[model samples]
Target chain A: MQTKRMTFPGKWLPFALLAPQVIITLIFFIWPAGQALYQSLLREDAFGLRTTFVGLENFVRLFRDGAYLNSLSVTVVFAVGTTLLSMTVALLMASTVNRMIRSRSTYTTLLVWPYAIAPALAGVLWWFIFNPSIGIVPYMLEMVGYRWNHRNSGSDAMLLVILAAAWKQISYNFLFFLAGLQSIPQSLLEAASIDGASPFKRFWTIVFPLLSPTTFFLMVVNVVYAMFDTFGIIHTTTQGGPAQSTNILVYKVYADGFVGLNLGSSAAQSVILMVIVVVLTVIQFRFIERRVNY
Target chain B: MVENRPWANFFAHTVLIIGVALVIFPVYIALVASTQAPGDLLRGTMPLLPGSHGIENYKLMWQSGVSTANSPPAAKMLWNSFVMAMAITVGKLSISLLSAFAIVYFRFRFRMFFFWLIFVTLMLPVEVRIIPTFQVVADLKMLNSFAGLSIPLIASATATFLFRQFFMTIPEEMLEAARVDGAGPLKFFKDILLPLSVTNIAALFVIMFIYGWNQYLWPLLITTDPNYTTIVMGIQRMTAEENPQWHLVMAAVVMAALPPVLVILFMQRLFVKGLTETEK
Candidate 1:
């Protein structure tokens, strides 16, 4: 909210500067969000002839609906799976790369370019790698007499989507984890080492605790990412198939609204998603403000 | 200087090697697969080594995509992606720069309200409100056009905030000096503020370019026309075939991912700066 002490005296210029952004927001963002709210309260028949006001009915139906419940649970599992896998791998890689001062930039470059791969492209790459018939991973699995077919098995599909999503996210989490690791004061590590603590002990007692704020921040971000941003991954690979195994909430919103023609339900789902995003954004901002102090 | 452990250093090196291999595995496979002939891929497990058909497959995909998928050639799709990404990057950067300049330099009425309105966009991603947004685009007849692809998606709160934060750190004396030199608001912004913003703008352009290029859902919904398909969504179309030609598909995938990947590799510092600073 802070502005310059010496300001430009302008009445019309400020409005002119703001017009383009405000216009786009009104048309694309605010208007549609309003429409979603309004449509959530009305239901149309299959013929699209009559619409009746059904206050809270769409939301009430969603709570009762088994499919919606299934999607919610799937979203939670997917989000948790992605956050844990990516963050753990990133933390390990970051700590390892942090140790090698000479090879740090080289390893960072190799590790970070995957951040540029689109979620859809990432999915396709993994799909080919895990393609039950032709993929190398499956061939190796078959050597162990264990089959890996995402096309038929629900768990396999879930695992495949999770892996694809996690793969794209590792680079992002790595940079943050590396930044967090670098920011930890070296003197503390030396003090712990001088106390005869092992490297593992020092990491757990000193280094890990200091990285908590970054870890927490990345957790919220990764969860939000998995919930909303992995739509491309799911769409390209599973299409929410293998018996709805990979239908996260965002994908379900698209499916229900665009494909199923269930306007009221999809609108209601959109409103719910908007509320969830607002809450998550608020939590993230609050945490970030606190992290600034650290 | 507290201690030296050769064993620990060796262990860290081994871990880093394994980590890098895992990170590169998928792309390596895609690259290898793209070089192989269709017959080789269909015969069972794919070969680990690059095949002799590398140039052939890439040329085929670029010149004419899989006719079975009814998708346009990879060349056209890449062009569309480039155009869309550039439009979005330019649109977002220019508008955000102006608005941030306004919010920082001018004391105006309803400023806080407008700021909050822009901030509201951070929470409402297009995925949540897909249908209504689609309807709005449809009603405005923006579907299947560049305007539909980029404009609706360009009102960015993150970019504006990034510029605003950067602008806040500029010394107030610069403004006072400009005013003493008999400079108008527009003149100062054009001369002083614009040059100071160059680095931030470059960094943000890299990030936003990647974001705009990699968009999947928005283009998919708006552009039912094959002519307007981006490479990202175009890949989906190719893969939707009953038995996709893995060779050509991989070739298309490589081309689709190359630009942004190269941008990151070359401008990594700016990309990192843009990412870390924006999130804060």
Candidate 2:
């Protein structure tokens, strides 16, 4: 809110310093995004070289394509499912960790370790545990006289993907919530206890509201990560197989552009995905920025 | 304060223990699998106990060319991963710190516009621009090279955003004091701000290093030659090949996964602090 003189020597210095980052970002990020936008309007041949302009035909074709529609629905389901499950687990873990009298650091370290491993490695770990032939989970299920085949069943595949995504996410959300819990003033909880509030009542009335901002921030970040970053796990484990049940929008983009060599459609899909993310992020900021005091 | 209630304490500790076990069991299984022999691994008869064949399996993996060209060893892939991770980590850190310093300390026209320009990149997923980005890399003749793996990822908006937030928290009086001492802008950054940013730098370094190490798709897409394959790509190739040896594959995975896991374990406190600071 403070206005400073624009001619200050240091003022231009920062802009000068920022030139490298700006140039790199433009060349790699902005340029590519612009190129993708342009290519989305043009037609391409089988070998992936752009040939001619097709205007909005790619968008029109995408809308009519049932596979794209299915991918959209699948992505929505995956994002929502992972977000909700990871948030719930994170909340529980944060509150439980808050109650510990000792060794809390050790527990926190152990719990958060999973996030340090690459998502690709996490996918491989899960693949081994769920592989129908040698996976430990399927073997255990058989030992209990029930068949658990994730590869063949759509629901099972969806569950596996969600579970893998959620497992990696718990550490991220848990760390934030735990920090928020620790920062809450102890006096407020003490006063509530003195008023004869039940434990559940005190949490609901005092702690939950205070943690809302952290929760909201986590929600936005978690959803974005789930939609975009989980492609590694999905691609490695299922390759969006078994009738493409696990095919999310990001994976679809990769398949269309790289594997299928349909650059126009892929670029169009990318544009749609970008639009959805930007719109949702804007809506989130508009609403949550009002309530988030921190 | 009320005296600690034993029953309530018991319930809490039990739940925490269960959570820890659930979190650790899969990792434990992976480690055990890594130690078993090929026959034991194939038969799926190995229990959740450590085996004595870890060295043998590792040797077989090296000799079998699981990660290298024809007769080359698996160590080549590990070296490739290390080089790639190091390049991205060092590159991202320097650029992020400089950009963050500029955005925070120096007031300029269009400063916020530039900040938002970098921030917008955070929302655009790499998958969305993979084709064009790949084409650019191809055009630059960086394909299958370390430069291809590291150059495009050097400018990370998340790191810049984080560094800016960290720099903002440093009291303004410090900078003004440095200016009063006749220190130039670069002198203040080098002598004052950089020293105070050790904690943030360490935290971001660990994070960026892990991120670089975990990359699979980009490495796979960029490198066609087996000689240049990273560990993740190597593991994927192993899975795709006929008669894929689960023991060797899992061993390679454990090897690939260990460095980052150890780094996280050691920097657990800093990791938590770094993430918490970002949201703040």
Candidate 3:
């Protein structure tokens, strides 16, 4: 890349323009992250006031705590499950929509509507459908002589959360994948077809590789979203219930800090979650970046 | 070899139509259930058809404390949502636009560093920072205030990053031309850059608005009082107590979800355009 030389006025203007954003982000974002880190080191007394530093004690407690371990496993399962399912479905949808000759915009718009719905509302929607007595799907299942219960089992609850989270993500990943698909040159696919390759073969050999970059980007984003964003549904539906089967790291953090008032433990969980996210993201970038042509 | 296969096209369309229907069925169920009476809803006998109890449900929802001494009115909660969303939208847009313009249009030391700093924040979800953010709001005495709800979210790294990328795409010759015509930096931004970035601004505005509208946890945490309850918080509150009113809760959820749905429907073009632009 060529370095463009800047005039004196140009040199100073950008900093001035960026100052407000920098200041605001530092105050609100960086400061809070710092506070979370600092608080993680301090032990809080019963009255919600920090009294002394207990370095590494919180982490030790977290490792020894069974509930914390369960929640960590749940978080991993939820994040991985939702990401895989959502990305796969999104890729399928994107490919299908791309193949269509008409109503592409309509299909795309309808598909993306679920993304517009609040996650909280999506939870409520699923809650109603899965309601044991009044929920239509569950009731229909019972009527058909099948027992379907989400509230009574941890695995069921996890499945519900995964489904709701995955549903919400479909539109987002679809939108990106569609954009990625659209950017691939028509000539390449036509040339593959001309060489007597089937549609499936063309997609596998040509289109899939071309779309890998978008797929990788969506994977990182989808994983992050699953880890962080699905708390609303968890809070509303499960509250990490059925003997804490559905409790994830983020929900555990919220429960400990806000509801449980165990700020130290919450902060500790926060640190752990952050570390995991950062490590995973670094691994993703290192490995996937090489595979992404772009 | 096959230029146009009707059977293949038919099979593809059939599969896609089913996929699309599956995608939208849940939302359709929600809308239908929203129109039913509590009795019908509880019985699970509510037909898929629109019901006569739409107004009744709305009335019950309003009386359920979305409005009054006993309950906050649904309309008031909607208004609260609108106010908070609009404030966050405007604040995020202006801050993001200014920052983007500055980063792209001006050259400064640590520019790339600042970009990465902001970009990294995009990955740090509210879950990780909620505890500290709660403390900040409590310390600021902004708890239960709209400012507390809106301010923390005003500077979105994603928005800033997107806008900066978009601003970079603007031809430098325009800015140079304005500068040569004796326009200062501010004038150049306002006269040349701002006008050209309207499409981006519109797309980002809708996206940020939807984001603010859908925010659940932070607002739920900061706004302790019912008076400050946003639509999402209100919906959560509806289910928090014993003997939770499912009908009223569903109604609230519907009302809460309406704005973003309507915005997306009306601005579908801009929504896609915005996402595409951000990727670029």
Name the top DockQ candidate: 1
Q: What's the chain B TM-score of candidate 1?
A: 0.98
Q: Give the count of colliding residue pairs in each prediction.
A: 0, 0, 7
> Alpha carbon lDDT of residue B239, candidate 2?
76
Error of 1 at B83 (Å): 0.4
DockQ of 2: 0.55
Q: Write the per-residue lDDT of candidate 2 for residues A172-281, one digit (tens) a residue.
A: 88888888899889888889888888778878998999998777878888888888888888987888876898899999999998889888899988888888778767
Q: DockQ of every model listed?
A: 0.85, 0.55, 0.55
Over the true interface residues, superposed, what is the Cα RMSD of model 1? 1.1
Encode model 3's per-residue lDDT on B1-280: one tens digit a residue.
2357788778777877888887777767777776877677776554677777777887777655633223488887888888999999999888888887767666667878888777767656777888987887799899999999898888777688677666666666776677678888788778777888888889988887888898899888887687777888788777776655666677777778888988989999898777665544
lDDT of 1 by residue, B85-186 (tens): 999999999999999999999999999999999999898999999999999999999999999999999999999999999999999899999999999999
- Residues A249-286 of candidate 3 have per-residue lDDT tens digits of 88889998878988888888888887877776676667
Name the docking class for model 3: medium
Model 3 steric clash total: 7
- Candidate 2, B1-280: lDDT as tens digits: 2235678778878888887787777778888887887778777544679798889888776656563322235677788888999999999989888988787776678887898898888767677788889898899899988999998888888788788777767777786777678888888889988899999888878888888888888898999876778887788777766666777887888878888889889988777766665544
lDDT of each: 0.94, 0.81, 0.79
lDDT for predicted candidate 2 compared with the true structure: 0.81
Choose the strongest candidate by lDDT.
1
- Model 1: share of native contacts present? 0.91
